[model samples]
Target: MADIKPYTIAIDEERLNDLKTRLSLAKFPDELDEAGWDMGSPLADVKRFVKYWQESYDWRKAEAELNSVPHFVTDIQCDGFEPLAIHFIHVRSKVKGAIPLLFMHGWPGHFQEVLKVLKPLTEDGDGVNYPAFDIVAPSLPNFGFSEGPKKRGFASEQYAETMNKLMLKLGYKEYVTQGGDWGCHISRALAHLYPQYCKATHLNFNSANPPSYFTNPILALQHAILPYTSREQRGVGRSKWFDEQGRGYNSEQCTKPQTLGYALADSPVALLAWIYEKLHDWTDSYPWTEEEVCTWISIYWFSTAGPAASVRIYYETTQNVDGRKNKLDHQGLRAWSPGVKLGFSHFPMDIQVQPSTWVRTLGNVVFEKEHESGGHFATWERPDDIITDVREMFGKGGGAFGVVKDATGYAS
Candidate 1:
C-alpha cells in the first residue's frame, strides 16, 4: 500500500490537439469496388470513423466517465525488468469475505472491458445464491496507461509476476482470475508459477493444443473415441479460418513489431485502421457506436507508453531470440497446469475455438458452458455470459465452491 497511489485518466490537451492534427492529415488508401471486409478495414469505414473522430466524438466526456471508476497506480517490479507503474481499477465488495478476482485484458483491449461486469460482480450477495468479488483489473505492461519496460524479454512470466505482486501488495493472499486472449496465457502462467495464490481461473479463449495421451489420458481417450459434434466441427472451421486468413497481424506482431510501430506511432488514422480491423472482424457482429469506436482508438492514441510499445508483447513472447526455456512462452503456457480449479466459456467466433475436451486437458476443469455467439473479445461482446459463468463457477455447489479458504464471497 505504501507504493500505491490513486490515479485518474487525464489525457493532456496538447496530446488531444496533436491527435486532431494527425487525423486531419490522415491519408487514405484506395480500395476495390465493393470491397467489403475481405481486403481490410473498408476505406469507407475508416473515412467515416475519421470524420466522426474529428467532428463528433468527444474525448472529454469519455475521459470523465472513465475517471468515475476507482483507478489506482502502483509500481510493480518484476525480476530482470525495470519497475513499471501499473494502472488498474480496484473496487471492493461490502460482503464479509468477497473473493479477490483479477481481470486481465489482452492486446487491442484496455481496462475498459472490466467496467461492464465490475459492479455486478462486486455487489453484495447471499452465499447460497450469488458470490461477491473484489475486482482488480490491470492494464498490462506496455498497454493502456501502464508504463512499458525498457528492457526486452518481458514475456508472460513477467506479466504474471507483475499481476501477482499487485494482488499481494493489495493484501489478497489468494485470488481467482478471468481473462481471454493474452489474458488467458498470463492466467496460466500465474497458476503454474503461484498455484497457492492463484486459487482458480476462468477463461473465455481456447489456445490449447490437442490432447496428448501422456499429459491428459482421460481427455485423450475421449478425443480419440468420440466423434466430432457439430459444434466442435464448426469450431474447428472457425479456428482454421483464423489461422489461415486472420493471422497476418499475429505474424507481423510476433516477428517485426518495431517495423509496424512507426505507422501506429506517427499516424492516428493508421493506429485506428490497424485496430479497427480487428474490432470489426473479431466480434460476433456486435454493433459498435461511433463514440465507442473513437474512445477505444483514443486509448491507444493517447496511451501513456504510446501505441507502439503495446505491440512489443507479441514479439517478446513469441520469438526465442535469447534461447531461454521461457516457461511463459505462448506454447508452453497452454500446457497443463494442475492445482488451480478451472472454468471455461466457449464462444463460437473466438479465434482459437478448441473442443471442450482440448481445453480440459489444460487443467482440472470444474465448469464449462458453450454459447452460439461471441468472438475473441468475450468479456466485452458477452459480459453477461462472462458474469454468469463466473458466478456459477464460484457460487454454492459450483465445482470451485469455497476454494479460496475463508473468502466465500458473501455477507455473514
Candidate 2:
C-alpha cells in the first residue's frame, strides 16, 4: 500500500468551453412523429438538459462544495498482482463512536450521489456532531480519478476483491458496505468473497442467489409471468427494455466503447448527457427541474471525468458479453457466483424484484430492510431515511443473521 495523498478538485475552463461549443454544434438525430424515449433517450430531454448545463450550471460552485470534503488517493496491490491506485473521499464524523461505512456507487453514478449526505451526516445543530460514521466513498477502479484497471480482468467480482484489499490496506478489518445499482453487486460480491472482512452488506437491488436444491415456486412464478406482469423484474426486464429501446449506449460500449471514447472523453456535454439521462430515468424523479440535475452534471463537467469514467463499465463488462461462446443469457445474471448477497428495501413506486429463493438457497442473508420511500438513488433522494436504515442495519454490535420479516410475511 502506498501512502495516501490529499486530493483536490480543479476544473479546466477551456475544456468546458470546448464542450459547450460541441453541444451547440451537435447534429441530433431526427425524431419520428411518435419517437420518444421508447426508442432511446429522448432528444428533447437531452436538449433541455444541455441548455441548462451550458447556461446555468455552475461547475466551480460544485467543485468548491466537493473540495470542502477531504479526499485521498492511494494504491493497493491485489494479491500482489500489481498496485492499483484508487481515489476516495473520507468525511470523518465528529460525533463520538462513529462507525466507518464504505459507500459504493454504480454505473452512471459517481461519488457525487453519496456526497449529498456528507454535510448533514457530519454535523449536528449547525456544527460537527460527526454522528455515527467516518464515510469513505471511492471511485471504483476505472471510474473517476481512480486509474482504469491495468489488465482486462477487472470485473465486478475482481472489484469486490480489490475493495476488500483497499479496506484492509486502510486498516478497516471489518466495515459496513452500502451500494445501489452495480455497487449492490460489487458489495454483495465483497461479502460473498470476504464475509469476515465485510461486517454487513446493504443494497438497493438484490439480484443473485446461492445454489439451490429446489426451485423457489414464487420466484419461478414471477420469472414465468414477468413479461406479462405490470411489475418489472429488475436486471432482466430492464435489460430487455433497454435492449429494445435504451441499449444503444450499452451496445456501443460493449462493442466499440473505444470508438465513442473520443467524443465522451473529450466533450463535457456529451459526457453529461450520456450519464445524466440514466440518472434522470432510473430515479423515481424524472425531468429533473434544471437546477436539481445540473448540480450533478456540473461535477462531471468540471472534473472532466465524464467520458473516461463512463467507459469504465464498458471496459469492465465487455468481456462478459464478447468472451461467452454461447448466446448471452438475458433473463438473469449467473447466480452462485462469488460476490455479495443482495438485500432489497423494496419501494412501492419503482419496479421491484424480490431476491429469488435461488439466492437464499446458496448463502445466508444477514440483514434486510423494506423502506416505504426512495428509489434507485437512495442516498441522494432520501438521505435521512437511507442513513437511518444504514445505521440500524450496520450499527456497532449489530450481529449478522438478524431475521427481517416484512409485513407481507416475507422473510427477506
Runs in model 2 deviating more than 4 A are 79-82, 120-131, 209-248, 301-306, 318-342, 348-352, 355-362, 396-412
The local lDDT score (0 to 100) that residue 282 gets in candidate 2 is 60
**What lDDT, from 0 to 1, does candidate 2 have?**
0.60
List ranges where model 1 is wrong by over 4 Å: 321-326, 406-412
**True lDDT of residue 347, candidate 2:** 44
lDDT of 2 at 342: 40
Best by lDDT: 1
Tell me how far the alpha carbon of residue 157 in candidate 2 is from the true structure, in angstroms, after superposition.
Answer: 3.8
TM-scores of the candidates in the order shown? 0.97, 0.77
lDDT of every predicted structure (CA atoms) = 0.88, 0.60
| lDDT (tens digit, per residue) of candidate 2 on 6-60 | 8887767786687678767766666778785555567787787778777776767
- The numbered model that scores best in TM-score is 1
lDDT of 1 by residue, 1-412 (tens): 5568889899888988888888888888988888889788999889999999998889999999999988999898988777889999989898766889999999899899999999899985665557988999999999999999988788877888899998888888899999998889899999989998999999998978888888788889999999988879999999998988899999999999999999999998899999999998889998998999999999998888999999998898887735654557867887788899999999998888899888887889999999989998988898999999999999988988898874532111
Error of 2 at 134 (Å): 2.0
